[model samples]
Target: MAEHNTSEERADDMQTQQAIAVEGLTKIYGTGESRVAALAGVSFAIDAGEWVAIVGPSGSGKSTLLNLLGLLDRPTAGRYALAGRDVAGLRGAELARTRGELIGFVFQSFNLLPRETARTNVELPLVYAGVPGAERRRRALEALDRVGLADRAGHRPPQLSGGQQQRVAIARALVGRPTMLLADEPTGNLDSATGADILDLFAELNAGGVTLVVVTHDSTVAARAGRVIEIRDGRSYERDTVRATPAQVAAPRQLQGVLS
Candidate 1:
């Protein structure tokens, strides 16, 4: 009985150490009758290395939830724990430091400097993290290589194709070696083929033990995750596990098909 009790306690401790923990997270805008509750009592857990897709309709609190999780916005009530640390109350430099070390961000706009080369753009995160110059270049080049953009390292954003530019953005995200990635509409600006390529890269990264939380309303994009999390009025709804049916399966293919 004592051994069994010890095992149970260990399991509970493991859960507490998850990559993310959201509890009763609430965010409100305005005051009085005009007050808009962006998030209600949203709560969920994301384990390290899990690829979780969050899908919801417009005004469904998707962006609001992401902002909270990313530490970019504050919660009016409740708590958030990232890597087991309570960050709900952190502000200013403390919050900025935590955001730098623990989280990576990717946006749909391919937020790269048009004037900077792919390699230079990928180095920006390291610069913020205060890594040494030589080490920064090494890591940036490694990241670019990982995303198959090494050949285009010297090319500016305008010179690279849209797909390549997105890849550069992804490399920038990874260059920080962050614990989890928060992508908001990562493929929103790309064509179908290009978007598919970006998804493939995400799969490859997730397979290699990078945690992913993607905010997308696109059904096809959401379907690629092992689990789908929907946020409505700031509450999380883990609707169902998503998988490709036998009819939907294709021949063994590249990174894009791995999740499916």
Candidate 2:
């Protein structure tokens, strides 16, 4: 992958390194009179290494879109491709493997196993991916180091501070080195100061060429991303890109590629 690209170069070549592409994406629940169109023919594309936020009020289909993007649910009628592969038809072991290897997710709630050490929690994805124990340990430690949490690897979630717990969650996400990172309200539980630091980490990761797609209602959170997509009534609308940190700019808090 290109280490850096001018905005023009990036835009011009987005199609070549597409991370996600959806066309006429729709999701329906129930049937007949009870049927609801949770997502209505929404369509969009996100390029590799780009950071995009999905924002909308509650019940506006933001969650629906996020679920589809994260591969937690399938669209009822549409084409969805992730990491340059068509994922709309994958099922059983194939679908499970693709989801495990192609995406890393961070939820608003730090979902670490309270009884497990940070290292073990970070190793979970690798386990599901069928990695060898020794390799998983190496990668898990490497991932914790990336998130600045290597020192806390022996601590369980309950023993860490809230911010530390979140860091551990981030480490877990990075352990797989997936094609994209999907965050849902990643900073929702932290104070503004701590949240900013987390955002900075995300910026560094993006600078290091990780693609990020965040779901948040906070404008400040959305502003941190290079682009934003708003969902309403099951439809999607793209907003012009804005920034807390420019998508391709060197990370302000750290040297570029620090997380690579």
Pick out the ten consecutive residues of candidate 2 with the lowest summed lDDT: 251-260
Q: lDDT, candidate 1, residue 10?
A: 59
lDDT of all predictions: 0.79, 0.80
lDDT of 1 by residue, 1-260 (tens): 33666876756555543788766778998999999988887767778788899887788788788888888888898767787777856888888889889888886577799999999999998887789999999999999988778899999999988778878888898899887899888777677876787789889878887889999877778888877887765566777522321111221122112112
Candidate 2, 1-260: lDDT as tens digits: 55587876754465457788776789999999999999888767788899999987788787678778888888898767776567767889988888788788886687889999999999999999889999999999998887678798899999998878887888888888887899877887777887887898889889989899998878899999999987777877776533332223221221111112
RMSD of each: 9.2, 8.3
Residue 23 displacement (Å), model 2: 1.4
Flag regions of model 1 displaced more than 4 Å. Answer: 1-5, 31-35, 158-162, 241-260
lDDT of 1 at 47: 80
Full-model lDDT, candidate 1: 0.79
Output the TM-score of candidate 2. Answer: 0.79
